[model samples]
Target: MSVSEQFVGGDGVISTPIATGVGTGEKAEVIGHRTADAKPSGEYASILADTPLQADEAGVASRGMYSPLTSLCNEPRFATMRRGHKVMVGQNGWLERPGSIAKKPEQPKKAGFFDSLKRIAKEVADATEMKSSRRVKGGERGRASSRVRISLDPREQSLLYCELEFLLTSALDCYINSQFNAGRLDADKYKKVVDAWHQKGRPKVVGFRYDLETQLDLVFLHMKDFRFYGDRASVPAAISGILEAMRVNARALRVRTFCQPDSVMAKQLLDSQSLLNLLGSAEQRQIQLAEVVQFFKIVLEREHKLQRTEEVRGLPQ
Candidate 1:
């Protein structure tokens, strides 16, 4: 029978098994010696060869034949390995330990001054374009050339004119009371009167209405003392202002009546126009208290006539 055993050499080489046999009826002989000139082949080359080991102490101590299985610690690729420390495989296939690899520092990206300005300019341009587009659309809708003529009958036109005149009178009275008598007009009633006049169809009356309302607001603000001032200038100024507004209203009414030549309101419109013209001429020559009184008297008489007509016709006041 032959016995053989395999072993790995100290230089990290694997050796083949060597076999020895005993002849029949003969004692087994030990063959521990081989010729010095012998060179090994195949798996037993490093084990049986007579080559001398290299005289490198560090190389001989570091090399292991069964490093993957028998070695308890792995050699580090970049740093010294300490006892009881955990080892890890790095991204580059190197053995790494704790705190061995340094992290790359991060840098922030900086923007140039011109680049910031360009971004702000672009935002402003976008906003301006949007605003311009909105303005164009608004202009197209509200252009005066797009206005159409509105038609109304004689009675309806007269009623609308009378209502506007009444609203203007009420606003003036309210202003006078507040400024002279320290009276407070009922805000709700004032707003209702203005709103009612606004609901009527009188496109031409809008300008004078706004003028009256603006003057009343100035009076409420106590912009001037109309009762007495230098040479009674404030009173004349106030009268002239009211007379100018009335003239404007009367002119708009005349135009409306002229459009409908057959309307019965034409007669009333003519009379009102003549009175407004007279007042305007008087105001141009420096308004007097007598002329102001006469103006009020004429307005009161027209209002009284309208009330009488409405009552005679069984119409609501």
Candidate 2:
């Protein structure tokens, strides 16, 4: 019998069978199985399929990172289901979040000079053992958070695409290992952790000799769709980062127009508004930035008040 026609018989046995007379005289009901394709299709379907009673899939994702830890009965019945099924779709990395190009709120900048130094000192003072609560000052000027600023290198700001693909894989593993069994990680927490750990972040894509505009567009794309923003100040930093990365990539990739624009001379460029507008237009990430910045300002103000209250209750360092 031909291969196609050979698989025909009442017992579902087309190929050679272990038990020759048992079902071999019949037909091959199934094609493949755990050990071999000796089982019948009707029987195997029930075995492989996932039912309400059975929660795990007996297969691994491409990267072999994910698989369901489902139990048929879970000791007696659903034993907590803590370690759920894992399906590694990809690898590990960042997935750009959606953003807008909206209007930013009007707020004073962080500082004219010594920005990081001042902030770091304050944080250090607060967390340090050198300062005692008895001598700490209480109630001071209320400060508005206004915005969030993050800085990175000027080249290849975004994670590799393949690496990003793995984020799903990592995310799955993370979910599997996490205490939460809700099957999805908290997005806010994920961004905070990832952004905090993001190194080599910048605008330019080293060794990639693509169009300057296209490359720049991608930098904007990350802002518009990948990176998360918190406030007005964030936009500037994001813009700065992307622009700088592009410039850096330009040098390495031999692509023109990849370096930071002339606007980087100061905090706000000589033509600050215009530069902002240009980047905003290209990135199409303005709308969201504006909204978030306004929201963060309120949060910052609250923080400032809390700090003041604590100071008023004590002395100065």
Top-lDDT structure, candidate number: 1
Worst 10 residues of 2 by lDDT: 46-55
For each candidate, the alpha-carbon lDDT, in order, equals 0.34, 0.28
Per residue, candidate 2 scores C-alpha lDDT tens digits across 1-317 of 00111122232321122222443334344332222222222211110111111111221222243211112212332222246455433322233224633465699777632243334333433322221222322344332211221111132112111222232222223222221112122223333333333343533211112234333433343343333222343575656664665444434434222232211211211122222333322121222222222222222334444556776887431
Q: Kindly report the root-mean-square deviation of model 2 from the true structure over all alpha carbons.
A: 25.4
Off by over 4 Å in 2: 1-214, 217-242, 245-276, 280-285, 315-317
122-231, model 1: which lDDT tens digit per residue? 44334333322322224565554323222333543454454444434433433333222222222233334444454774232211124444434433333333232222
- Those runs of model 1 whose alpha carbons end farther than 4 Å from true positions after fitting are 1-148, 183-223, 226-247, 250-317
